[model samples]
Target: WADGAVGPEVAAAYSARRVRLLDALAGRGVAAYGRSGMNVWVPVPDETGAVARLLQHGWAVAPGARFRLDSPPAVRITVSPLTEADIEPLADAVAAAVRPSPARSYR
Candidate 1:
């Protein structure tokens, strides 16, 4: 669905193909469709067609939820320069502060 160029003809073709696919699915008793952001960013043309096709096929759009957690701010203490003793404590403190959490861990 990544259309490099956007034009009337491309839009029409995309709409037609989407309808055809939906119709085929309907014939098989598949009334629901779930589309996620598989691509890093959805192209504008593809997004338009997707939304139109979903509504045309009687699908309802639902709002997605956002979940975020607030964490305590880190203490910043600037020094002119640091020796090995200063480096070890700072590194240890950072490692402890960055322990894995559900909201902050790399997936």
Candidate 2:
């Protein structure tokens, strides 16, 4: 499909979607790493919690632990099925999952 059904237009669309996802996450101050492809690696405080929280928001993401045990907690989010409209909401959910609350508050 890479050279046949998936032509330049298709590839470009995928790239755009990937970039949009990355930009959205970055805009929220979330450190996501994704130079290419549809998958984005977003580091979080807890991979399990982030995955669960994202699932609660109707997003099914894979925990980084499934791929690497030595790395810090993170979640893998794919932008394959995500449209331009879905980018912001997904970013918001990711941000919320990554930073649930302030580490400390002084009153």
Candidate 3:
């Protein structure tokens, strides 16, 4: 889940985008769910109410699950499906959004 204090308008926009993506997945008969920082079970068949409920708590559903290292309870990571097409565009967008700086550089 994405956690940030984005304005309602922005949040709604993100929500709408996610819903549309999920709807497309649903149409394809593909099940998807988002794993968030918070420990909560989100079911398939994503809907507005479910999305809103998650957002209210500062969580955004991605397309995966959260896993923890057996040896370290504190070590946890969220895994999501990624395709080659998604990687380049997503990286480019992130690069474009980040403010370039001498101290904190990203490519």
Across 46-87, the per-residue lDDT of candidate 3 in tens digits comes to 334444443454434332224423321111112133333443
What are the Cα lDDT values of the candidates? 0.33, 0.85, 0.35
lDDT of 1 by residue, 31-93 (tens): 323232111111122333343443454432221111113422222222213333443443333
- Per model, how many backbone clashes are there? 0, 0, 2
Highest TM-score: give the candidate number. 2
lDDT of 2 by residue, 19-80 (tens): 89888888999999878666889988888888888899999999998877688888888887
Distance (Å) between predicted and true CA of 65, model 2?
Answer: 1.6
The weakest ten consecutive residues by lDDT in model 3 span 71-80
Report how far off residue 84 is in candidate 1 (Å): 67
In model 1, the Cα lDDT at residue 100 comes to 34
Candidate 2: misplaced stretches above 4 Å? 1-6, 101-107
Query: Which is the better candidate, 1 or 2, if ranked by lDDT?
Result: 2
| Model 3 spans with C-alpha error above 4 angstroms | 1-4, 34-107
